[model samples]
Target chain A: MNDGLMIEVENLTKRYSGHAAVSNISFTVRRGEIVGLLGPNGAGKSTTMRILACYLPATSGTVRVAGLDVYEHSEEVRRRIGYMPENNPLHYDMRVREYLKFRARLKGLSRRRSRERVDVVMEQCDLTHVSRRIIGQLSKGYRQRVGLADALVHEPELIILDEPTIGLDPHQIRAVRQLIKSLACDHTVLISTHILPEAEMTCNRMVIMYEGSILAADSPDNLQRFMSGHSQILAEIAAPLEELNECWAQMPEVEQFDVSPAEGAYHRCALTPRDGLDLRPRIYELARQRGWLLRELTRNRHSLEDIYVQVTRPEEEEES
Target chain B: MQAYLTLTRRELSGYFLSMTGYIIIAAALFLMGLSFVVLLEKLQLEPTLMPVTELFYITPFFWLILLLSTPVITMRLFALEKFSGTFETLMTAPVSDREVVLAKFTAALVFYMIMWLPLLGCLLIVRHYTNDPSAFDLGAVGSTFLGILLLGCLFLSLGCCASAMTRSQVTAAMISLVFGATLFLVGVLSSQLPLRPSWQTQVLAALSFFEQMHDFARGVIDTRAVVLYLSATLFFLFLTLRIVESRRWK
Candidate 1:
């Protein structure tokens, strides 16, 4: 029924002047899902997020946020979504508490309700320590936190953050990442970032784009599973590797295997799986029967980084 | 209504918090105080000085201070938001652009009024020291301030519209100066035009802010003058709203 979806975008496009900033793209975020919109620069990630936040209108196509059409019911949709734009601009002249209170009011909270929310968000974002500190005088990390607290002061159902951890140090990045992960308990969080590792660490599902188009949208696990060569096995074996290679090549589980003779009557070996099955058991069984001593056996699964690069690779030919 | 008040309060507090507000007020008061001293001394020599009828406080130099002061007070109204990238955050909030435009307009208008507060100090000083008990012309004083406010309303809106046109405060200030000076010159030069008889009414209708202020300083609050200033303010405020909305397209 699409009832559990928090965002539904179809054929959305945004064109500036004669150029299309965001070509036709479509994706969805289910309720309570931590979705990441990941892409390189100029890949329309910000434009798509802005459209979904109701900050910018799409050139064509329909987007619904919280079951409300972004174009026709923008105000209502805005109320439902807390959007932190790229760089997370804030009123630097204001104190953290003052800024949050004002933002709460602007988001349609009454004075008493706004005060309560100011405290709640400050506590949630861990901004209570700097609640009375001037935003301009705070460190960059503190300012980023204030921006996030301001976004959630109204207690929106969905939260959208654009590059939430763009300029943070390693420690601050970790803190912000944990804060985002915690938010998914009550919020449908959509984060847009070119920082691939950040997205992999935080998002449950990813929308990877390249050249103004979505190349893939799936869970991180599913994406890695979808890659044809997802894992590699490495081993060092003794006792005449040529005989073992002949037997391994005939095994059904071994997709391909390479063996190179090494010093002291040993061989370096590597193998890939043909099916989506772990070949460690079969390899061990075959080794026991063949009387070949297995010295080292290790398997490495494909990471999101590999799949991200494999899917969103830039074209060899540049766009004119 | 609460939303409007919240925006207005934020804007007003922004002035008191920023350096531009203090600089504009100081510059305006310095020039105003200079004129107040020079004019008071000059009129005292004539032995026929009245606190109210002395148009020195509301003379050409007064308009000069206004022309110089407007750009500073209103230059950052919208341009700063655009420059700081806060406009996106603000526009995406539940509030409408109309509320934003009005709130800023009201804040600039209020700051403009604050700049004129020093004029009151000058007037009260003139009245207290003068020998004649009937020296103060309340009507002239009231009407002159009214004239100042109406003119301030028009120029501040012009400055606001200029701010909306760009993301640079310096450029916004330049726009305010260009438009403010152009309108002031138009108002002054229209009367000097060698017009045919029928053109007199058209010139008076279109360009008479300078003329209106002259009459008001002499205790004339013409309805025509009031209507022109209010409409010009609304017109520019409306233009600002449109510019803000059009930024989404750009």
Candidate 2:
């Protein structure tokens, strides 16, 4: 039976001779969801992706792709999953069109279908311009697209990319990110990257892995909120510390406040809201009522980096 | 089956599209031409009972060409994929490990056979110029080609096994070179050494690739040699398949 789930991994542990690469990790991805396996280097992201793509077998536990057990139905799972491995490895000697067509045919497409998909994927990946050029002669960005085109040529149900944007310039990264975002309409994407901005921008949900185990799994917004109970607000005003303390005490939205002296006459006041409330307007109105010189009034929301760092800090500290 | 054919075509085109394949063919042509001229001179200087095919197949240059070219042809089979990081993409395709190994072996063996095609051309050129109908027997030449094909199968499979074991093409070539040289050396040493036991002599004689080639050159179809080479080829291919599958464990 084809369930709504595209991938189902439970208690998956991949152990090398000396150590485990992925240890008892469990996660799932629904169809048509862009899920990011976010982790740093040596975090077993590639190892997990490899296992899911049927390139590597797990030492223990089970992985199912499209309701088929990966170990037992590897050929079927591989036919359904298009995997662009780390570094986007490709045949350097083959031209783009030739390579994509070869990959399409290898993935079980008919001859005419392979040709049609090669053209379609080449256009989708913006590789139409360099379709005749040798892959070894192409730039890194074009090579990355060619790898992407190869992955997409067969029109697989699931696309797994490991560090798809790595080693690309900002422009290329943005383009690749947009391309990945567009793929979510038709296919389920399970991309792994250490770049927080990439996950924040492209992925609908993220599973943060650290030291071979999943640390957290949620949407970016929920992760930020769950990591810290409430968001903080920063307000710098050229007013006395006692006045700021009295002003903060007056507003119940300001659950906690700390005032530190700045250069000249400005005082930096950090306030944590009691709830997930926008305290910036209230702080601005307070400054106007008190006739205080407001230099800065802004909500200090946690970026994905901050949440990732906070989530991964305990284990990093334990290792140290 | 389609995936296997596609992979085989890709590998065969890889050899031809690059300069390595042409260089190999050119070197084989030169070596074969030189050996032919040397054989002609030796024949002109003295008469012998051996047929032209027997003399041509028994030349040291023939064995040297086979020994050297098979490694170069097969070294890039799996090692280059691993080196370029395409092994993941290749293995992740729907094809099984057996197909992957067999495709590479078949491609290399085909290329090896193509590399020796110049010898037939040399034979034809000699036959045309001399206008001698009995210069080289067609049956002997056919058996000689069959013997070469069998040996090519064994050598290419051994080289494929070596290539599957390592990522470095140079290391793969060296390993297969060692394997091929050891096989040849055992044959040579067995013939040279005076073994007292009759069974030992019979076994070594059966194992000797030189003896096998000599018999085939004389149009003698020895089923023992055919079975031995075929079995060894299968054994090496089985080893290569295991090596390719070992990546799952690694």
DockQ of each two-chain model: 0.61, 0.70
| lDDT of each residue in B1-250, candidate 2, tens digit only | 9998999899999998789999999998999999999888887798777778888877779888988998999999999999988999999989999989988888897888889898888888767766776666899899999999998999999999999989999999999999999998877877776866789887887778877778998889999999999999999999998888877763
Residues B133-228 of candidate 1 have per-residue lDDT tens digits of 565678888898898899999999999999999999999999999999999888878767666567666865467777778888778889988998
lDDT of 2 by residue, A223-295 (tens): 8777555678888899988988887888877789899999989999999888667788888887898899999
Provide TM-scores for the models: 0.96, 0.94
Q: Which stretches of candidate 2 lie over 4 Å from their true place?
A: A228-230, A236-244, A259-268, A281-296, A314-320, B193-197
Which residue runs of candidate 1 sit more than 4 Å off their true CA positions? A228-230, A317-320, B49-54, B193-196
List, residue by residue over A1-320, the lDDT tens digit for candidate 1. Answer: 46999999889888988699888888889999999999888889898988888778888989998888987887888888899989889888998899888888888899999999988888988899988899999999999999899888888899999999988999999999999999999899999998888888899999998878899999887887877465878777886866877877788888888898877878888888886567888878877887888888888778788777776775663333
